[model samples]
Target: MAGHDLGFQVVYRGETLEYYRPGGWVFFQRPKDCGGGYWLGRTYDGVFMIEYERPVSLSDGMDFLASMKKVEAKSEEFDPNYSLF
Candidate 1:
């Protein structure tokens, strides 16, 4: 599938992220409830980075997500159940 056929755009910090269904999913991790943090997305192109406009504080938590060094992955390695959310 091509990007235009089944793609979605994600807007963050006034930036647009063009994601395609055939390109798999964009994966990233950010801080939780400790002011505004950064959002990094691992897409078929490269690591997508975004920053919040303002900071907001709340409960604190930490989570580490795997980094995608390269955009291309083996078809068998693709996870159907995987999602960025």
Candidate 2:
């Protein structure tokens, strides 16, 4: 496993957590909502869409996530695309 220390955005409900870099794949490991274990997030296309990975335990999840840096979403000028509206 390569060092997973790339600045990524934390995805909250409704916020567009889209990003990319010129490298291999980047992923995120977060605690599961059900509280059993944790789930992983990955990219799809160019947008930062979250794809799940095999579930891991809490301790394992934290350790895996720790390997990667956490970045809170930064969209000071987050404007919605309302072409449909």
Candidate 3:
């Protein structure tokens, strides 16, 4: 599934950021005035990164949150030794 290709990495500042997805998702680690909001997207072939600004609706945020929850849940099902990191 597409979500399987989606992963995340913690940046140097300790913020958890999404990565390697077929398409990007917007992330706001801070308020807008601080340039805190940005879109992290993937290329059409899902091999590159694209950053941009776009208004994200509440429903879209909810959906992304739900997907994140699922990812977390799945992570719990794995054996500790299986962790790639």
Candidate 4:
């Protein structure tokens, strides 16, 4: 979580997605390989990462992620460091 700050890079499959932290909200675009769209990125705070249903524009995805939030089983409950969403 070192680069969770605004404009930090989130890397997946060698692809890079930029993240933004406005106020206490952290959002990042999901890699296409993992299914594209923006997600409510993980935070050091209590907020858990949220996934999107369909691919979306980065700005719109970020804006709507909270409302689109889904319930996911906590990683620590079943599999360590593994979130099922």
lDDT of 4 by residue, 1-85 (tens): 3334433334433443343343233445566777775554445443445444454555665455434333322323555686677
Judge candidate 4 at residue 43 and give its lDDT. Answer: 50
State, as a TM-score between 0 and 1, how close model 1 is to the true structure: 0.20
lDDT tens digits, residue span 22-41, model 2: 33344343444545443445
> Residue 39 in model 2: shift from native, Å?
4.4
Give the local distance difference test score of model 2: 0.44
Q: For each candidate in the order shown, give its overall lDDT on alpha carbons.
A: 0.34, 0.44, 0.44, 0.46
Q: RMSD for each model, in Å, please?
A: 13.1, 15.1, 13.0, 11.8
Error of 2 at 37 (Å): 8.8
Flag regions of model 1 displaced more than 4 Å: 1-12, 22-34, 38-63, 67-85
Q: Per-residue lDDT of 6-33 in model 1, one digit per residue for the tens?
A: 2222333434454443344332233455
Model 3: per-residue Cα lDDT over 1-85, one tens digit each: 1233334221222354344334544343334565544343333353545343463433454466567669978886757586567
**Candidate 4: segments with Cα more than 4 A from true spot:** 1-23, 41-56, 62-85
Alpha carbon deviation, residue 33, candidate 2 (Å):
8.9
Give the winner by TM-score. 4
Candidates 1 and 3 compared by lDDT, better number? 3
**Candidate 1: minimum summed lDDT over ten consecutive residues — where?**
58-67
Higher-ranked by lDDT: 3 or 4: 4
Q: With candidate 4 superimposed using the best TM-score fit, by how many Å does residue 15's alpha carbon deviate from the native? A: 9.3
